[model samples]
Target chain A: MLFRNILFFMGESWKNLFRNGWMSLASIGVVAVTLFILSVFVLINMNVHHLTEVIEQDVEIALYIDEEATSDEREQLVENLRNHPEIKKADFVSKEEGLERLRDQLGEENGLLEGYENPEDNPLRDAYEISMHDPEAVSSVAREIETYPAVGGVEFGEDVVENLFDFTGVLQVTVMGLMVALALTATFLISHTIRLTVMLRKREITIMKYVGATNWFIRWPFLFEGFNLGLLGTVIPLVGIYFGYESVLQWIDANLKFFPSLIPLETAMGQVIILVVPLGMALGIIGSLISMGRYLKV
Target chain B: MIEAVNVTKKYNDGNQALKKVSFLIDRGEFVFLVGQSGAGKSTLFKMIIKELVPTSGTLKVFGRDVSRLRGKEVSVLRRNIGIVFQDFRLLEEKTVYDNIAFAMRASGASPREMRKRIPQVLEQVGLKKKVYSRVNELSGGELQRAGIARAISNRPAMIVADEPTGNLDPQTSMDIIKLLRNINVKGTTVLVATHDQQIVDELKKRVIYLEEGRIVGDQEKGAYVRAL
Candidate 1:
């Protein structure tokens, strides 16, 4: 653990890492591919989460007012809806707007709505449309609004809102599950690559043991190799992520506008770098320990 | 110093590699453990280093029972006994200087100490001219010399060379044995296990002869007698 021992172990590991050209290269490549797979899933998970958030925003309740209610009472209802803790947004639709929307819907059939053109004759009532920050609370919020004397009825299609929440929750959980499995796969994949290098130098380890090296002394160099392989392997994919991810986002923005807008490059990359780089290093260390376990007994 | 009293090693397959073999090697003595293949010289050497614990009876190195040494204590025991192998066993990819430095580093020598001590070790073994040559690039004699340099770099109290000149030519063998003898003269106890009758007879040091996992002869300044 001293600085001197660390320096020597690092120097020894650096040489052993390249001792077998193909074996070392192969280990690095395996780490890269496994990490790259994990990153792709992470990006997918982030985008899906973003899309679900956008959909949740559109899940609002339409509360029509009783025509018999006074203007002051309608105004008070709008204010209360807006001030509620869970409410994210509220919009008041005047009776005239209600008529206007009906007219637009009946475009080709204008003659049928000719009598209803006047605001007084319009059948639609003034309504307040409100959405909650958490879509899961839609039904409870709708039920609470229904208790208002001035409010006619609340309609937010209970089944659709519940189903949307269910679908998004399942998607997020599945993606997270996949990420855990991928991380484990990356560890084993990296370990297998490191094992080859360990075998190539198995004789060297025995000689080290014969030379009176402590188990730690023999382990330090291989640990260094494992750590380096993982770190270097991450660089390939991170470089792939850093320079290419933004351009991929731009391409999606131009060609697939209907798709949910992906998280901004800077934010997505921050999340990925924090999670993946350490993952790579951890995988490397674990891999090295696994590969070295049987050999260090001498 | 090593002491063995009724030491026996039985493998899992019930084959006894050593049968109550006992001997005492005092400090600063040169001894040749001479035996044929399968005669248990290797097993006895391994027991001294605590690599293989005795199945029965007691074996002590440095006055402590080796069979009772724990993990870290085993390393301490080994560090006190420098071992040489028939194959030279130097890391093929490393230079001679680095090979000896490995031994010093294993024994926790400081960087400054290693730098100061390596050249001296190389000089003692006559490996100074090829100090930077990779092990694979050296001739058989030079490799053996580098191995010896590494074995003595840590200044262990005893040197256990298991067939040190096993793979060398007759002349190289003689030279390696002479170097070991010189190190012994400098007060480092030396134990060499060899089948070479010429070196054993020529040196006429304390010889312990083994046959079929049993010590048949032990004598002061003994010749390579096959227990006649």
Candidate 2:
């Protein structure tokens, strides 16, 4: 009996959907546009994170060892730094290599150095270029490395690391705020749509109530209708997200070839597909339920 | 069997729709409640069906106190007490068959039972041939028959019809009264609220007359009496 009623309910709900074709389309359109905007926000947020990570990878701490340190001591210091959980990579840079790099940077400005003694006479200590696992981890790792007797000084762009961290924090907050606002807007729009639909069926509902149909029996089909509308709305936006993410990645790859390790468009697309469908359906169901709550009482 | 003990109903606007109305209707008996507009015939019908709670009196229908019924209990009570509206309250979007089937479904009738019983009810109401006809396509008389078919689809213990024949032709009205009488003879209590003097005089069944939300007369085989 329950199964049969469910079937009949679903059939009736579908008929209602077709009967109110333009209204259903309008509701679905609202859902689709809202989900599309939400998906775009998600994609942009992910890509921004990817870009920031790339920039973070390039900022590293340079640790200069004491001049009196032996090769073995220096090797031990390098090994210790490598084993540190915060360090991504560590390599030794000899004094000669550092002098050569400085000279390369000062090319064609040798006139300023002509009257001065040979810059190589005061050989700088061997230094270890250590990339931390994350830009934020640099300060703490540098402090730990400073405790080593073989280490003289540590240098890294603290301001850049702080700026990157702050940027990510602000992005997260903004995304959260935008998501909450969009969710409220979606709820308002979808609920009003359902309210209008319920108003149109007010007589039918009143008659059903007169005929002794339970609250659940009358409510289930309408709720399912809303869920179906939401699901339908999700289809177009999901497909659009997939194609849009791919096309944007393609454009970036073709035009901005300098940036490497861009986030895979497929991964971002998958995330959006996973998130938007449930969100849309939840909004739809909640909206329908709220409207039904008022109108079904009769 | 239905019984009201001094039932009273007052609307929010301070209009008293039913005022200390009391009556008893025996099982398997047909009764006519006659009154002019705003005389509380509909209010009495609403009370019997538990659609409106009395302001200060008890109403018992089919051994249940309708005055106190709520939630699933009200639905359960309604399942055994069919109601027909004067407007024929059929779902216009549904076919005659679906309209009757919906009544059975709401009462939790099994599909097998529905399959066997829906056709039988439609046949009883002479709507067997028009079972699949949409309500909008049916004539005023046919629609009334469809409404009757839906009312009796569940074989309810009692049927409360408010102005069932008001919109039908004289012959169609007689046909509807005869149909209700037939169902009453078959053991379902039937209550018809109408002011059709011709039908009331012709049928000569028990009559309860209401005037200004109060029963002014009760008679056996009565004529329609106009009371202000």
Candidate 3:
């Protein structure tokens, strides 16, 4: 009986597909477009999260020491900074190295420094370039470094780091909101499509009822129709998402060489494909079920 | 067996289709409900299938009270009672064989049983050659036979046909009535709602005559005696 019902359902769904050809086409088209847009939004949101995390991992705070401290005291402070639990890596940049870095940034504009007395004569503090286990732990680490007698002050740009973190938070919330809105709109479109399909088959359903068909028997075909629509709709968008992710990855790899590790294109593609098929099926099944529940009662 | 005690159905628009009407039909009996267009014949038929509830009354079919049945119980009741509509209501897109098989499948019949019984039912209805024919391609008589095949496919204990030959000619009407009589002879209670005086007079079966939603006459082996 179960096997017969399944075969009957498949056959009926196929018949309905042909009988309501234009409407079925419209339904499938709507499902495909809505799912495509939703998949794109998910891909964008995930990529943004990946990019933010990569940038966060690269941000480090630099702590400079007081010029009055003796060489040995400065060395001790450097050792202490390296041993801190939060510190991933800590290296001291001598005053000469700092001046050299400034010179390189100034380029040929170093002619302005020629009028000054020996650049080495100017008092400059040695700085520790510190990388921490977590970007969020930077402030506490800075405080600890400031208590050292040899340290002049922590010199990391607190405002810049805080603003970057805040920007990423806002971006995450905005993406989440957009994702929800897209999903709702997709569901609504799919639902409307399925409802139209039901309307087209109303007469056929009434006849089925009078012919002694059970409610589930009448419902199975339409459920299968919805499942097929959802599955078909996911195909194009999943392919588009794959190519889109690859293009973005290629652009980042070529242009943003300074950015730390990029997410591999294959991994992103695999995840998108995994997520899209089920999402498509869910949308299809849910839309069809809702429409059928309201209209197939007879 | 079918029995109704003071069954009443009042539409929401203040139209009382059947008002405290009562009747009884025995197993293997061929009965006719004769009435005018607005005289509640269809309402009584609908009530028998539990499609419409009586405002206040009791209806028992095969010894089970239909008024208290719900969900699957109602469906099960329907499965045991075959119903034919005035419009035939055949799935126009399906072949005759498929339509009959659909009924069997809905009642949860096994495939082996369906394969065995469908051909037998088709031959019984004299449509063995037209089994693969689409309903839209069949004549009025052939379509009615297909409808009969579907109604009787599940071997229901009772068959309720509302205007089974409403759209056929006089000759076709007799053939359809003869088919119903044959089904009746097979021990399935048959209740037909019609105004064909010729058929009623010719069959001379039990007739329940109605006027203004009230039974005016119910006689054993009676003829059509009431006029509009």
Q: Cα miss at B162, model 2 (Å)?
A: 0.6
Higher-ranked by lDDT: 1 or 3:
1
Q: Against the true two-chain complex, what DockQ does each candidate achieve?
A: 0.49, 0.46, 0.35
List the candidate 3 regions with Cα displacement exceeding 4 Å.
A14-41, A44-58, A62-89, A92-128, A132-164, A269-275, B226-228
TM-score of chain A of each: 0.61, 0.63, 0.66
Sorted into a CAPRI-style docking class, model 1 comes out as: acceptable
TM-score pick, better of 1 and 3: 3
Q: lDDT scores for all predictions? A: 0.83, 0.80, 0.79
lDDT of 3 at B189: 90
Q: Name the top TM-score candidate.
A: 3
Model 3, A68-174: lDDT tens digits are 89989977887787678999998778777877776665566666556444665845667878988888887778887789878887855456546656875786687
Docking class of 3: acceptable
Model 1 residue B115 distance off true place after TM-score fit, in angstroms: 1.8
- Candidate 3 chain B lowest-lDDT run of ten: B219-228
Give the Å shift of residue A134 in candidate 2: 9.7
User: Mind giving the per-residue lDDT tens digits that candidate 1 earns over A1-298?
Assistant: 7799999889978887777667667768777876786777677667666866776667789998997888788778877887899898888887788777766655665566678776668888888878788888988989988997799878885675456568757876876777567666656765666676677777777766766778898788888888998898899888888777789888876665345577898898888889789988888899888877754555
Q: TM-score for candidate 2, please give it.
A: 0.80
Of 2 and 3, which scores higher on lDDT? 2
Tens-place lDDT digits, model 2, residues A10-62: 78767667767877787787788778878887776776677666667777889
